[model samples]
Every structure is written in structure tokens, then in C-alpha cells.
Target: MSVKYAKRMDYIKGSAIRELLKLTEQPEIISFAGGLPAPELFPIEEMKEVCVRVLDTDGKAALQYSPTEGYMPLRKIIAERMKKSGVEISPEHILITSGSQQGLDFCGKVFLDEGDTVICESPSYLGALNAFKSYLPKFVEVEMDKDGMKMDELEKALQANPNAKFIYTIPDFQNPSGITMSVERRKKLVELAVKYNVPVVEDNPYGELRFEGERLPAIKHFDTEGMVIFLGTFSKIFSPGLRVGWVAASPEIVRKYVLVKQGADLQSNSMAQREAAAFVQMFDLDAHINKIIEVYRKRRDLMIETMEKEFPEGFTFTYPNGGLFTWVEMPEGVDAAEVLKKALEEKVAFVPGGSFYPNGGNENHCRLNYSCMPEDKIVEGITRLGKVFKKL
Candidate 1:
């Protein structure tokens, strides 16, 4: 039973949130550990109709093998949607992938080599960190303020690491931190990438989920030199189980993704792409997203309010206008993992923020998800967690 594995496997580990999900699966546990969407808001009936229509009209084509570049109609729909984010793109430059998670893997495959450096926000998305880690690259995490990653620190990192592969960012209501990059910073980020001659991988799964303020243009929108790679997904706005996402870049760049796609999984789910396109054609996706915004905005508001009233003094958390998470920073000496142990005793769960950092050592933080739980459960869970933190 002896076997050998690749060296890259040494850098890979199971996701902290994924492991926590298993522990919190009990019926009574009020889990806020996962960045999951509310199941009640899914378009089950519309999808049911869309599925039968696709099968009845184009059954074989729906199930058959598709181009690595994805279904033309779906790509076109995605391209049209890109205009909302201020990017004028064509379907020819889009390559469909299983999910944005796969898009992250492709970025690693295309840009990284052993000992290469990656520039990311200090507390970036855990999933992206794991995906990039498989390539054995060193991470240079930049500090962040309320407006997202700091530009001066990013410039210093870029200057310090000349062999940096790419700058990875979740600019729109960023995961774990829930901070959005301002419009000026978005433009400055592109400027820095252009100057540094490094590509910017914009992981924007939550850009469209804005609950307040005007929507800002994507980083790719400012990329006149085609140095930005935009990853878009249906997981947040539509069905995650469909596993439909795309890489929108320049033609030359996306052709590389298509080649990678052929080697990765051949193509994304054909039926799922067709169904997503049909759903768009058959219904008002904007209205559907509006419904999601209404529900999640209320949840976000309630969670922030409850935390304000219940949590003790000196503990700080973000009041996110949109997205799934809000990060809580405990006092310097406090360990969130210890807080979790006590909270679990009261049938509650959340992700400790230490694992969110690729280089580690911020154990006094935690990420809370409000988009998955009901209002009553959110209140009850935050109250229980408040008591746990107060004890510490």
C-alpha cells in the first residue's frame, strides 16, 4: 500500500470552511461557517421549466459534447452581461469553465512555476489561496484598509518580487473581509499592473450582488493593454450546482484558457450552459437577482445590528453593504479558534480567520456568513457567539 505523490500535494490541504461544514451539519447547529446562498431563493420552478424546454427542443445537443470555448449562445449572453460591469467583450474571447474555482486553477496553471511569487490581499479568499498553493508559489500578502488592498504596499511588493506571477483580487465585496475596492483604487490597480507588467486576476463572483451605492466598473474595464483576466460565475447569482462560469480576457489570453480547458475537463457542463442560457432567455434574471438582493440585504443588516448590540466592547466587525461575509477582528491576544470551541458547545459555528491568510498568524479574527441562515437563526447564533467572545 505504499505510494508516492507529487511534491505539489505537500502544499495542498483540505479547505478549512469545507472541513467546518461537516462538523456543523447537525440539524440543531446554527452554522454560519460556509459562504452559501439561501436555498429558498433558488429558481427551482423556472429551472424546471427551462430544463424540460431544452430537453424537448434540443435534447441531443444539450447532452452531447460541446466546444471547449463553451456554447456560443451562453457566451454571448455572458458577454452582454459584462456590459453592466463596464466591460465591452465578445463571446470569442470567453472560455467556459466548471466554476470560477476552475478559472482560478487555470490562472495557476498558466502563470505559475515553482518559487514564483503571488501578490494577494492580506486576508484573501481561502479557496483562491488553496488553488494557487498547488503551484508551489510564494504569497506576498498586501495590507488592506476600508477601500481594499493598499496601492503603495502593492507597489512595494511588485518592486520586491520581480518574478511575481499575478495580482489576485476579489475586488467586489471581498470574501472574509467584505470590503469593496473604490473606483479610484480599481483604476489605480490597473495602472500598477500595467506598470509592473504583471497580470491582474480579478475574481468577481459577487460584483453583481450590490445592495447599496452605484456599481463600479470592473478592473478589466480599465485594461487598455488587455492585462486583466476577469473570472465570472453563476454560483452567486444563479445555481452553483450548474457549475457554469467563464474566463473573460483578450482573445490571445482566452485562447490559452481554451487550451487549458481542453486539457482540464474538455468543456464545462453542456446541459448546464444551455439551461443557464435558456433561463436567461425565458425569464427576467435581473428581477431574480433583485429578489436575492432583498433577502441578503436584510440578513446583512440584521447580522450587523445583532453583533453591534450583543458583542462586547473592543471587538470590531465590518458592516458590509453586499456579499456573503463580514470579518470580525478580536483583540490582539484573543484566539478565535478557542472561541469557536466554546461556541460549538452552544450549537453554533463560524470560520476562524487565521486560515484566510496564506502566510498565517492572525488568529484573533473570524468570518461570519449571513446569506445562508434565516433571520431567526442569525439572531440566535450571533447572540450565542456574543456570549462566547465576551467570556474571552
Candidate 2:
């Protein structure tokens, strides 16, 4: 019944998380499925006032087309912010993207040709895997343990597949797994990438959300050869609705991204960019981030405590120091998707870990998000989910 479509369409599939979100939208369901921030924490009042101020001060320019590289003031703010992670880059090295997600697609577009190999953590972010697949590149998923992607496995993969475009990683509080890379491995990873002569794309959306423990400097900090590309986003710390994220790389690489961005969406939302930049200029983001940390830290604790009390044997999960997620792995034979079907019937939800892998197989794991739900809901949802696991 359909008309002809591009062959690339064959490689694409609807996002599993987005599909699950529709079923979890009911008020009765306490969903841990999305990497969504709590609406209660959004600076609604601040945003409203900022919008009015921008309109009164400079309406036309704020609403009009902006430079493809992004608003200069915002870029300056981001460049300065990078120093906290031990990275020292000028605004010239940054390319503002719609979200860090766009930085992923552009990496695929900028580096991958059809049949080229792309490497990532075994159970990497599903969104990045989905983005890379659209270009028809072969995926090489390196296995992972508690301390981020295994360097030995990664180097073997890199050595075997010398055609790899780049190594994609989320080194801090990784998606789905909620595991941070050890500082030792961080240096080793940079060394391996340099030894292999492959570029590293370090996606760090959740680095600022640490609730406890030391915040490690980004993998980009160890990059002396300029082989690392760092991606930053305001979505986690500020507001996802604004969709402001940036790419920091060599000026030459950033220029290529700027050109690709022109062919993609021309540029990100111009109005939102100004509103965000103005917000940064006027407000204290670190103070706001502290407020977020307080609430989320408590939520993370409640989820872990409840699961520890209620979950049956053969069920184990991560207790992360920061970020929104805690990963659960069932016994070897159990299928997490099947468990989710039962959890949904009880009005609870989470993302199955299998979909996070590009070449999928491990169906016994799932990822629970703590930032979107309140303390009571976190307790209740995990209790409900625990009962489902027991029955399974």
C-alpha cells in the first residue's frame, strides 16, 4: 500500500523507548522508562520572565535566523563551562546542535560511509545506535563491565576492524547502565584511541548531575592529540524542552559539523537558544543544578532501598553515585521484556536493556530512571516491579 521509499528506511525502526512511553502515559502508571527530568523542577517562572525580557529587549533578532554555529554569547558561555571538566576550548571549537543526539547523527554523516564500521559500548545508548544505523554502517559493540567499556575488548575490536570510523562512548554515568569510567581506564582509553589512530566521541550529557562522590574530568581532558570529540547538553541540567546541546572538537571538525548542520535543519531553534543564553547570563546554573541534585539523590536512594528490600534472589542492580538511572539484570534465562509486560499490567514501566545494543542478545536486563518520579512513586513502582520479578 506504500509508495517507494529510500533503501535506508529499511534499516530504521521506531524508538523502543518512545513506543513504551505511549503505553506508560496513563496517570496510574509509574514509569521509569524515559530519561525525563521531573516537571516539578523545571524553572517555569524563570523561563516565562526570560521570554518576556527577551521580547522587550530585542524581539526581532531573538526570533530571527541565527548563525549555524550557534549564538555567540551562548557559545562563549559553553566554552567557559568546559574548563570545569578540565577542557580548555574557545567558542570557535564548538558547534551548537539541536541536542547531543544530533551530534551523534552528524558523526555518522561526517565519518561513516556505507559498510564502514562503527564501535560502541555493547549496551550503548539506543538512540545513538538508531542514529548510526540509518547510514548503513556495520556496528562493532565492545563488551562492558562496571567501569565503563572494557579497554581490552575495545582495542581488540579496533585492531580487528581497522576500518572503524570512530569509537562512541558515554564515559560518565552511562545511559541504561549508570556506570562511570574509572580514571585509570579513562587515561588508558585515550591512549588506546591514540594508539589505534581512531577518534573518540565522548558524549557527556549526565556528568553534571552527580549526587555524591568526585566528578571526574571528561575523557576529552586526557586527549592531547585532539582525537576526542566532546558533546555537552543543557537538557539534563536545565530543560530538555529547550533542546540546546553542543559539540566541542578541533575548529576544522567543528566547521564540517556546522556545514552538515546547515543541510540538516538550517540551525536549531533560534528563540530557544537566546532564551537559554539569556538565562545563563542572568541566573546561577550551578545553584539550580544543586537543587536538582538534592531531589534526585534522595530519589535514587529510595529506589535502591526499596528494590533491596523487595526484590527476590537472582535480581541485582546498580547503585549509582549520580545520574537518573539504575540498571537491573535478571537471571540468565529470564527475559526482561516479558517481565516488563507483566510490570506494565501492574502499571509500572522501564526500558529493556536488549534494545540498547546494536547487535542485540542480552534480554535479561532493564534500566530504571529515578529523576522523573517522586519518592513515594519510586518506592511504589519498584515494589510493584519487584512483585512482578518474583512471579517471573
- Top-TM-score structure, candidate number: 1
Worst 10 residues of 1 by lDDT: 18-27
Q: How many pairs collide in each candidate, listed in order?
A: 0, 0
Q: State each model's CA lDDT, in order.
A: 0.94, 0.91
lDDT by residue (1-392, candidate 2, tens digit) is 96999889999999999997886568999999999998899999998988998898879988899889998889999999899988999888898999899999999999999999999987889999999899999999888888988998988999999899899999888997999999888899899989999999999999999988878999999999989999899999999989999999987788889999999999988888889988988788899999999999999989999999999999999888898899998999888888888898899999998898788789999999999988999999999998998897
TM-score, structure 2 vs. true: 0.98
- Which residue pairs in candidate 1 collide? none
**For residues 247-333, could you state the per-residue lDDT of candidate 1 as single tens digits?**
999888998888888898899999999999999999999999999999999999999999999999999999887899999999998
**Where does model 1 exceed 4 Å of error?**
none
- Model 2 accuracy (lDDT, Cα): 0.91
